[model samples]
Every structure is written in structure tokens, then in C-alpha cells.
Target: MPPKRAFDAELQALEALRQATPEEALPHLTKTLTHRNNFLVSKAATLAQHHNLTALAPNLAEAFPRFLADAPKSDPQCWAKNAIAKALAHFEYQDPDLYLIGMRHLQPEPVWGGNEDTAGPLRSTCALALVQCRTINSHKLLLHLIPLLADKELNVRVNAARAIEQTGTDSSALLLRLRAELASDSPELLGACYAGVLSLEGPSAIPWAARFLPPEDDAAAEAAMAIAQTHTPEAVDILKSTHKRARDPWFRKATLSALALTRQQSATDYLLHLIEQDTQTADAREALMLSAPSPETLSRLQQLAPNPNN
Candidate 1:
């Protein structure tokens, strides 16, 4: 089929799937499940999701291993891994605890989104998948991922950090180790260190991050945003005293965002003042929104603005 024609057909089928009554949809969905076409099988899965077709989720699992074991080697393995993640992500939402059993079936698989050569993609994506299973039961995944802290791959370390954040678990030692690595001169290692610490103790990082922040003109702004999570009373004391503070708006913006995360209610007035000073910038607008006063606090922001015309 011509590309557009095939797409049009798929869209029509999807619309029909969406419109079908649950009773009517189940049998057609069952027929589609037998389809060898990858396109149809996944579309059926999506329809199953839209209709809350809980019964079909397990049936869909019948084809999942093929979707994994059959991945052609020449193509990037990440695509297959990501498909597995998407499938598992949707299914686990139906029964959160099923993830423990499901993950055991999926482990040691290839990484979905990380660099392919190293184990980064597999480890990182696995960690993320486990994290998504949080709604099902995070403790199981948390127990499984803890040992990964000793994983030699820096990318794995970064992702494991994300997993910990999603689970809201503690990893003070790993975070401190990452914080210590922030002193390294190597940018990649330093980037990994910063990425790892952003979730658990963003404020605790101020002391270490202040020393290693790249020059404003360098392309390390994203890393700076990640690293800035460590800014806090324990960390930002360093930011407050940094010697060559960069002229970059983003770097400054990251620092301010971190500061806002501290919830220093006393600093609310200062934060509100800064947001007003840069009404046109999205970062400022976001920081203002984040700092919204609680029931105990009054509305400090007076400027009601629309989203920028991005």
C-alpha cells in the first residue's frame, strides 16, 4: 500500500475501534490480536487501552516475547526495548503488583533509549520501566534496583537516580558518592554525577556544584540544570559565594529554580519579586507558578499571563 493510503486505513480502523461498544469491540479486538502485522497488533493494544479492555492485556502478552526475541540485530535494539516498555507500562497500570513478576520476565533485556554500544540503554530503560511500575508496587522494583547503584556504567547510575526519585526512596550514600564525583574535571563523569543527585538531595548539592559549574559560554547549561538540584542550605552556600558566576540566563535561571525548590517560605517575597522582574521569560513564569502559596500562604503573584506564543 502507498504510505498515506495505509495510514488512512489504519486511522479509519482506529476510529472504528474507538467507537465500538465494549461487547462488540472485544471479538474484533480478539481477531486483530491474531494479526501478524506489527502495526495491527499494537493498534489493537492501544484500542484495548482506550476501552479499558483489561481482559485483553494478558492476551496481548502472548505476542510480547516475539516483539522482544524477534528484534532484528541490525536495527537499533532500543526500539524493541521501548516497545516492551510501552507494553509493560500500560499493563502494569491495571495491576501494579504484577510488575514484580513482569520485570523478572523482562530483565537483562537490551536498553531502550540509552547509547547502544554500552549497557547504558538497557540498564537506563529498565530502571525507567521499573520506575513507571511504581503505581503498581514500587517497593519490589526499588529492591531490585538498589544493587544497581554499584553498576559501573555511569549512564546506569544516572537512570538509577531517576528510579529512586520516582519511588521516593532514600539513597544518601550513592548520592554523596555522586556528589564527591562532582569534583572531577571530566565533563561526562561530572555530568553523570550531577544527573544522579538531582532527585534525592538537590539542595544538598550546592557546595559541590558551585565549584564545578561550567563557564556560561560553554554548552553545559543542561548539565547545570541537572546539577543545580543540589542547591540548598547545605549546597547553595557555595552558589552564594561562587567566584566567576556565569553571565548565562539559563544558569542563573537554574540556580533560581533550585532555590525555589527549597521551600524557604520566608524567601517567598524575594522569589515573587524576581518573577515579576522577568515577566517575559518562561523559566521565571514557571518558578512563579511553582512557588504558589499554600492554604497557609497568600497569593503572591499578581501578574496573570498566558503561555508564551511558542
Candidate 2:
């Protein structure tokens, strides 16, 4: 086993390499790829990817077989596989075999304890990586990924949903399946399904999604946020209606929070107005923070705060 000091040094070196430009650090990074330590190899892959080292494609391609062959028997190796997939997804290189490997990893395996909840991190990472595959055969890969929408693992389902959404293909059946899954009650699942639906059906999804809003015996904050994210005239109207009708303070706050997601000036004006109201100032402030308010919104928030100097 490597000594603590040696391991620490290796970590430091990888961090330094990550900060270095590809041009200045490619030589050292290429060497690190061959390191016996899985961590070092993973780090090298990540840094190469972050730098968009297209020049390193051949090296990454060479590393793919080793990463897949090793098969991650333990947690650390599993993490290494995840890192490798994460990096490869960012590579400009496109290979059908590599994409297939990613797809294979997305399938629930005995390694994942027969449940997606227990699936190794690599499964989720691999699912996401497959989405980045841009070959002519990529759409075929996506068609196979549709089954993963109902994956027991939230991570798998969410990533798969995002991948399908990115294709800009209609996924109404996929959305219906996701909504039927018992785990769809999860806020994360709802958010992913909504994202896919919005991409597939646009404003048409608003009314469909609003049925889950106002938290009727379920936490629908994410669903409401999804509606707000659409930023359509219809969506804004729904948010306003939901907020007006919300009887529970928490649900009201969630509705108000979702409104912050809209780019519409009306939404911002409402939030600003809430910030001045005694009953809503606290929730409004929190909602604005969550929304990542724009510069103009920031100035307005500062002006509205009782003590802007603070």
C-alpha cells in the first residue's frame, strides 16, 4: 500500500495538474494515466477531460478497455470506473464500442445489489456518459435507454431522463411511465420527469404537471419548480393561481419559490413585492437566493432589505 505521505503528494500533484492548462500539463497528465493507483488514473482522466484535451483522445481510448476490464470489484475501483466514464463523456472522441460499454454499465447489475438504490456510482455516471455519445448510432443507444426511466435507482432514472430530454425527441410514453413508477413520488423523480416532459411537449406539459402541485399529501416543490422553469405565459399563470390558493405556509413558500424560477418580469416583480411584505419577506428572501437572482434583481433586493448596509 502507498504511504499516507505518498498518497497525499499524489493527490496534491493531481490537483495542481487539474489547475494547469492542457498545453502545459499534458505530458505529466499522460504519464499519470498509467499510474498503478486507481485514484491517480481517475484524476488524470478528469483533468484531461476538464481541459478538453482532444489530443488525449487516443490515450483515453487506450485506457477505456483497462477501465472496463478491471470491472471495479470494490468501492474504490467502482469510483475509478465512475471517474473514467465521467471523463470519457467529455472527450471529443466518439466510439460505438465505448458508448456500448456505457450502456452496459447502466443496466442494473448484481454488483448493484439487485436494486438501483444500491447500484454503484458508476451506473449513474455511465448512464450520463452514454448521453454524451454523439455517433450516428447514438439515437439507437437512446431508444434502449428508455427503459431506465423507471429504474429503481433515482440517480439512474434522473440521468436517463436528462439524456432523453437532450435528444429533443418526444418522450410522452416515457413521461407516462415515469409518472406511474411508485418512486415518482420522490421530488427528484418528479423534477426529472418534468424536465423531460417540458422538453418533449413544451407548454402542453404545464397542465399535466400542475395536477401534482400544491403538495396534496406529497412534496411537490420540485414539480412546481419544473412548471416555473418553463417560463411560458401559461406556466406563470399557473404559478400565480397556485400561490393564491395555497393554504399551507410551507406549500405557499414552495409556490413562491417556484415563481422565482421564471424569467418573466412579472415573476420578479411579485418576488420584489413579497420582500417588502412583513408576512412574506423571509420566504421571499430564501426563494430569491434559491433562484440565483440576476444583477438587477440583486440591486432591487438590496434596496428592499431593511438594512442594505449590512
Candidate 3:
């Protein structure tokens, strides 16, 4: 577990941010980022946003003579960069201002993302900051980050895919390439790709994602249920077929319930059977019956298969 001091310090910093002006927060922000201790490193970026210093993105991008004057004073490059990214997000797309000042250093690299060793938090922080800015600079970020889809670390790839999804580019080629790059052999990678494509949604799901999901995998079942929730007539048919083909009965039932929605005939018997199952998943079974229930549907429940538990 992380130490309690970490949480307390972060809360205190956020509270101070709420109370102070950007200039006032500047000293504290710098102190946090530049601190020799690693404890404050994670929060530096978040602190920058709280002060609304993001409007200064232009100056920070170009000279940030202030931030640069201090960048060297700060020990970690990651900490400094993250803080700037947070500030840019606090403002929205104007990150070029900050990126401009740090050109020499940033030019060679462009943008940053998670790699094998990184925890998901920082990369996600950067991606969301970029997306909220909604600038073209971030749209171009895909080129820099696309490679990380195959990152050795699972969480890194997860965050990378999430970032791409946030950018909301339906780079069919990119998504397909990532899908092809992952083998059916590696279920984890398949799971990640499934998540990645599901995030993309739309008709893109049909030909592209159909192959990745097979009947009965818990993850695939979940995806089927999710697709059913879209309520597109075609999506509904596909989900129904997907569920029928699915070898996992319980998950298949869940998929049917979601697809059925107000269409009671579709799930009526299956849900009633599940509710009367007298099993460990009884809670889930009961919840499904309760959600999206119809009185016409309830009439069938009275005739449900007898269960000792019921």
C-alpha cells in the first residue's frame, strides 16, 4: 500500500491550490516538482493544473525561462514534463505554448507515453490532458504513441490504447494492425485489443472485431453484452447470434438480457430459468430480472421452474 503521508500531502496540496493564486501556487508547485523526494513527484503535474497556469502555456512552451530556470533544479525530467502537461490540460489545447519553449528537448522526442516500466497513471494523465485540449498537436500524437501498442508492459499498452481511443481517431489501419499484431495465442493481448476496438465502437466493430471474440470467453461474453447495449437493430441481431453461439451459458444469459431490453420475448425464459437456478450467481440473476423488467414478463416469473431458494 502507498503510505498515508502521500494521500494527506496530495489533499493538502490540492486544498492549497484551491486557496492560492497561480503565482502563489507557482512557488509551491515548483517546490513539489523539484523536491528531491520522490513522494511529491507524482503530484507536481496535477498541482500545475489547479492554479490555472495553463494559459501561460505559450510562454512555458517557448522559454519557460521560469520553468526551465527551474527544470534543471528539479531532479526528474518525468516530473517536470508531467507538471507541464497537466498545466496544458488545465487550459485545454494550448500545450504548444509550453511545448514550444521546451522545443530543443521536446523536439527530439515530441510527446511522451508509458513504456514497460511505467505505471498507467502518468501516461493516462498525459493522454487525457492532450484530448481535453482537443488540439491538432494531440491528433498527431498517435504517430508518436502508436508504437507503444506493442509495449512489453501490459499496463503501458492498455494506457496507450486508451489514449488513442480518447483521441477518437478511427485509424482503422492502426486498430487492425494492433489487432493483427496480437495473436489469438495470447489471451491477455486479445483481451487488450478487444478493449481497444470496443472503445472504437460503431460499425467498425463488425468485420474488425468479430474474429477476436469467440464464444464463452468471459471477456468476450462481456464484450457481447456491451455491444448488445448499443441498441442498434443490427447490433442486437449480432449480439443475439453471438450469445447463441457462445458456449458460456451464464454470460450468454447476461448478453441476452441486455439485448432483450424492452424486447421481453428474447430473454423471458432464459432469465426466468436463471432467477430460479438456486446458485451462487443468484444475486446477478435476481438483479437482471429486476432491471428492465416488464409486468408481462413478470407473469412468466410466477410459472418459473420451482427452486428451493425461491
Candidate 4:
């Protein structure tokens, strides 16, 4: 009956359920979903999701609000709520209200000096899930999601951008562009926005992203990386031009790294040229290796700059 022993027994029981037939596991999983322990409830919800137990979604739903009622104590880290929401999302639960509730929920538990909101992950998960809800049109969803782009949590903002990207609307692309322009700090967030715009608008948007390549800030690096992800000849050209124009060594290195990520033959050839010409040789070599270049490229690199150790 001790807490630790009870926890161990519960874990063993959950593990055992993994081996049972779906029918046999259902009742046990259902019962465990109601357990007071947040950890156990989280594990049970994960099992439910893993096994594709759509049948227990209602139970998972019930447990979600129960934990939310006294979130700080009942779900210190929003563990139970997070798991349940993820499971529900996996099931493609169509109800927008539940996701809406979770997207707005904020549970700030006590930290060392003050209270830190533990519900950011929960909000992020719900935001992503909300995108899949067919009932809510893109406009309404964006209305709800737009505010989260400025969320206090960096991860939440990043995921919020991703969720908007999932909307795949022209409006969504514009929203990302606006965010990318307005966000002065948080390169990661800018990266997400850049990626979203690239994804939504395709190759034509490369120029728009390239504009950010100036100023040689972290935002520029993010823009370079995002453009490189396109893996198009245009991307290679854009990166190459940017690399040539960059006076900042850091920006040049970052552009080379992005060029390597493109995996295009032209990008590879350009990097090899840099190494052979002894222009940013170390960085070019590092970029080539990091890109996992083709065997021919690798052989050429070795020839151009033979390894002393090899």
C-alpha cells in the first residue's frame, strides 16, 4: 500500500496489459485511466494510443478534465492531460471544443523563484490537433491559432506556426510572412515561419525568404536553412549568391552549411570548389561531410584536400 510499491505494481500491471488481447486489455486500461496517479494515467493513455484503442477515447476525455480541475496537484506537469490529448488527437477525435479548451488552458505551477506555466506543451499539442478538426474552418482555426504565435513559450510559438502551416491556406502563408517580418528575436520561431511560408507558397516564395538573408543575423541563418530545405536548383542558386555577397564570416559559414543541406549537385560542386580553392576550406569541408555527399563527391573531396591521417 506504500506509494512507491503501489507505483511499481501499477507499472507492472500496465506492462502486462501490453501483452494481452485488445478485448482483455480494454477493461484494465479503462480502469487504469481512472487511476488517481497522473503517471499511471499517462502511461495508460499512451497504451491506448499505441494499441489504437479508439474505444477508450471517451474515458480518456473524461480523465482530461478531471486532471485539469486541479491541474497543479492532479497533473503537476500536465502529464495526464497531455497524454490524453495526444491519444485523442491520434484517434482523430473530431470534437473541436476539447481541443479549444486545452489550447487555452494555462496551468502555472510553482518553480524555484516563481510559477512557470507547465501547460505550454499541452497547448501546443492541442493546437496541432485542432488543425485536424474538420468542423472548424481554416478562418476560425487561424483566429484561434494566431495569438499563440506570440505565446510566452518558444516551443509553443514554434508549434503554433507549424499548426498554422498545416492549415495550408494562402492566408496562413501570409500570417507566417507577417510573423517572420515582425519577430525580431527567436531565430527558431523565424525558422518555423520561414519554413511554413516556403511550404505553403512553394518555390516562388524563395525570394521572399531570401530577403531575410541580409543583415547577417540569426534570422538570416534561419532563412538560409529554411530555403535550403526546398532542395531545388533555385535554392542552390540563392544560397550560392548569398554566400558570395556575405561579408560576415559567420553568415558565409552558415550559408555554406545551408548549401550543403540542399544535396543538389550544384551545391555539392560549389562546396567542393570552395574547398579546392582554399576559400573557407574548413567550413566547406565540414559542410560537405555533414551533408553526407555522394561517393563521387567524397572521392573528389579527398583528392582536392587529401587527409593527412588517411
Candidate 5:
């Protein structure tokens, strides 16, 4: 029972964490997990997991049961189960009971609240939780997730596809079929489904993801990102070429950013080369700033700077 009006202050603190580095925010987030309020604890768990604070795993694991026990009999606005499941998933918790309960509780359509979107977060997160189940066999998790592909909520269906992807299931055929369905029904889901295929098939997904790139459609930026995320040698070459050839500055910048996300030596070298050239330095520098700057980049920036003695 945190003091009344704590939720507002808690929310503000959470927002501040977005700007704060993980190192700076971990202490506050850890303290928040010990708070009595369910919503605050759930939020802290989510923040910790998002920051990849593995040190907080034991705390999150202990907190999950308490959060579950405190869950409202009816669906509440500050639902904790979804957040808890998200945190636990990051820690690779292997509790089958949690997964089973999540699967069982999922409704194809919203059963609570006046709006139909209310249940999407919970059901979708449950699908995500299945993907993170470490102790269970992948096949078993697959069995639980496959049915969710047909869920009415886009979030649930997309997450289910992602879960299947995480299970290393050969879901190319299913993914293609779902892509076609999403093409007609829900365009937003198509990107995630394609990403799932990439995760499952790796280079095999290049052809499909590439179709979304320039001259064929308006999804070139997105395709560039998806391809870059693969972090394969082929992806690196493709991204470099895409950045060079793209006429759209936004598209070129997107490709550069994607390349930076890979954080590979070759990618960093390419960016460094771009920054030395007059034609592309501005955009390359911007993207490099957005990336996790490497030691080489720091050294280069220093060399490029004017000496105070001069």
C-alpha cells in the first residue's frame, strides 16, 4: 500500500528513466520493485528487464509470484501479469504453469472493458512469455503458440508469430500464409511477420525482406532495417549498397542506422569511411552518434578535433 498519489509520481519517475542510462536508473528501479504497490513493482520489473539488468533477475523472479497473487479478480487498468510475464521472459524463467495459465486465460476477443483492445496486451504478452520458456521443450511451446496465430487481435497474432520464430520452428510456409492474410487484413502486422521469418530462416528471408526495399515498394526503410538486424555478412553488403544507392536521404539514413545497429567491425569501418568523405559525413556522423560509439570512433573523433595548442 504505497501512499495515495504515488502512482502519478511513480509514472513520472518511470518516464525519466527513458532518458537515463541503464546504469543510472538501476538503483531507482530496484528500489521501486520493493514497493508495496503492484503497479509500481510491475513497472519497475519491466524497466529492469528492458535495460537488460540481469542482476535484478532474482528480484523479478521473487516479485512475479507476489504480483500474480495480487492481481485483481477482474481485469484492472494496472494489470501486472503482462508486465511480470515480460520481465520473467527476459530472465528465461521456465515455469510451465505460468505459460499454461496465460494460454488458458487468453480470449480470442476482448472479454473485459468496454473496448475490444483491452485484452491485447495480456494475450500478446502471454504469447511472448511462451517464447521465453527455457526449461520446456521448444516443441511443447510451439504447440501452445501455433493456435494463437489466428487470434483476432493483431498484437496477439504478431507475437504468436514471433514466439514461433523464437522456438526455431520452420514456419516459413505458415509465415508466408500469414503475410498474405495480413496483406489483406492488417498491413501493420506484415512487418513483424516478415521479421519472424528472418529470425527463423536467416538468409532465406533476405529475398522476401528485400522485396520491401526500394523501387518495388515504400517499405524500403523498413526492409533495410529488417535486413540489417540479421547482422549477416550478406546483410552488411546489402545495407552498404542500399545506403550508397538510395536517392531518398531518409532511406539512406535508415540504412546507415541499421548498419550501425549491427555494431560489427566492418559496419563501423564503413561508417568511419563515410564520415571522412565530404559527400556523406553529415548523415554518417548523425547515425554514428545514434549508435554505440566504439573506441575506434572515439579515437577518430579526437584526431579530427583541433588541438587547443594550435
Candidate 6:
């Protein structure tokens, strides 16, 4: 059969299995997990995860390394391996060894100018999974995760920071703070690190994060937004203070936007006060709308800045 036709047929079969009873689907799903076609294997693995089929855990585990053997040819974009790893993680399969192998796997596939590592997603999935393993101590987990913070892929680095955050130890928070200090580029990575520290240390780390809120860089913007996500009274006050001190128009606007995201009554009140001003009104309204304000807040917005269209 043509590859497309074969793929279509396999998909239809998987869909049918999805609608079948778990008992009826089990054998077929298990067989499909071993299919040579990566797409088919991915679909089967997703179905297993969807069904919570704990019985297929070993099958998924076995299939992961098969595609990793000659990854570009067998798994292409690491599709099969990524899916299988996710399924095992969903099962909460507690083998740090499997996750460690995947977390370190780098599949550099041919692209136009150069090769891009297709296994970044697989590494990210495995990093998150590795943290969840009950057998590994926090120190070992952080040791494994720290290298990923400097991974070639931005998403891999970001998720490594997030996985570190999940460890929730003072050591993990310190690792994040250290990464935040050393990272000069990639605001998203900095944002993840900032969020991790704030999450692990709570409001007290607010002062440390606030230090990054000056100089009007993307890192500063990330800091502002991270601070805003805390949604504490302290967060609101710090953002309010930052907004007042900001000289750059873009940074000032960014601060207002961050304030809206706080979802605090005080932040809402500050934004409402800004809406009354001629210069700040449009930016403030745009910020509130983007925040997805509560109904009462929306009503207040409608009153103050009556939509010309309405």
C-alpha cells in the first residue's frame, strides 16, 4: 500500500480502538505500540495514556530505545520516542534510568543549513518525568536537571528550569537564582528561572526578583511579569512602584500590563485610576481586556471607558 494510504488506514483503526472497550482494545493497542511506523506508534502510545493502560508501560518503555537507535530515520522528529516517554511518565513509571537516558539523548537531524536536535522535546519530557521518580533523591535529580538549563534548545532550557522548580527544595531555588543571574539572553528562560525562585521561596524572594526590574530590558519585563503572577499585596505594591519609576514608555506600558495580570483588587483599582487619564487610558484599557477581568471589573471598565462601538 502507498505510505499515505497505509497511514490513513492505521489512523482509522486507532480511532476504532479508541472507541472500543478497554478489554477489547488492549491486545490491539499493545501490538500497535510495536509498529514500525513512528506515527502509528505515537498514536497507539497516546491512546494507552488516554486509557490509563498501566499494563502497556513496559511495552512503551521497550519501544522508546528502538526508535533511538537510528533516530532520524526511525523516529524522524523523535515522534515515537517522545510519545512513548510521555505515556510512561503519565503512568508515573518510576525508573530514573529510562528517564535519564531520554533526558540526555540528542538526535541531531538534517535541516537546511545545519542539523537541529529533534530530541529536545523528548529530553524535556524526560526531565519532567525524572523529577517525579520517587527513588531518586532531590540532590541527584537537581544534578541531572542542571545540565539541561544550558541545553541548545530554548524550550529544553525553560522546561529544565521548570523541572528544577518542581523539585521545590531550597537547593532547587538557589539553582534557579544562579541560572537567572548568569543568563544574559533569552527572556523566556529568565522568566522560568524567576518563576521557579518565586514559587519555591514565596514572597520573600520578591525583593531579589525586584532587583531585576530595572534597566528596561526583556529580563526586566520578565521579572515584572513574574512578580505580577505572585498576586500578593507585595506584588501589587512593587509593580505600582516600578511603574512610577519607569522612564521608558515601553517598560512603563509593560508594567501596566503586568499589573493587570495580578488579578488583585488593588491592581485593578490602579488600572482603573489609570483609565481615567487621557495619556494612559488606551494602554490601561488594553491591559485590562488582555487580563480577562472578572465580570465586576469588566463592568467598571465599561463604565469608565464606555466602548464607542457599544
lDDT order, best first, reads 4, 6, 2, 5, 1, 3
Estimate, for each residue in 1-310, the C-alpha lDDT of model 6 and write its tens digit.
9989988988999999888878888999989988899989999999899888999999998888888777799899988988999999999998889999999999888999998888999999999999889999999999999899879899999999999999989999999999899866499999999999999999999999999998788989999999998989999999999999999999999999999999899999999998877658888888999999999999999989987677
> How accurate locally is residue 269 in candidate 1, as Cα lDDT from 0 to 100?
44
Residue 305 Cα positional deviation in candidate 3, in Å, after optimal superposition: 10
Clashing pairs in 2: none
Q: Model 5 lDDT vs. the true structure?
A: 0.69
TM-score each candidate: 0.54, 0.78, 0.58, 0.95, 0.61, 0.95
RMSD of 3: 7.7
Candidate 3 C-alpha lDDT tens digits along 1-310: 3757776766577566757777777766655554444335445555566566664555333323334343434423445455555556566744433433332232111236632222233444554454454455544767645665665556555656666666666683356346545554344455555555655666556545555457466556545544554445655556656655766667655565555552434444545555567442343345445566677665665555333376
Instruction: Estimate every model's Cα lDDT from 0 to 1.
Output: 0.53, 0.69, 0.52, 0.93, 0.69, 0.91
Which sections of candidate 6 miss by over 4 Å? 1-7
Estimate, for each residue in 13-106, the C-alpha lDDT of model 2 and write its tens digit: 8898767877988998888777667677778888888888878777766766665553543324454556666777677356656655655553
Name the regions of candidate 2 deviating beyond 4 angstroms. 1-24, 73-77, 106-119, 136-139, 172-185, 217-219, 272-279, 289-310
Per-residue CA lDDT of model 4 for 172-279, tens digit only, reads 999999998896649999999999999988899999999999889998999999999999999999999999999999999999999999989999999989987899
Q: Model 4: runs farther than 4 Å from truth?
A: 19-24, 307-309
The numbered model that scores best in lDDT is 4
Candidate 4 weakest lDDT stretch, 10 residues: 301-310
Clashing pairs in 3: 45-83, 57-97, 57-98, 58-97, 61-97, 61-98, 61-100, 61-101, 62-101, 93-133
Clashing pairs in 1: 96-136, 111-121, 111-122, 202-229, 202-230, 203-231, 205-230, 206-230, 206-235, 207-235
Superposed model 3: Cα runs more than 4 Å off: 1-38, 41-45, 48-87, 96-116, 127-140, 177-181, 184-192, 195-201, 249-310
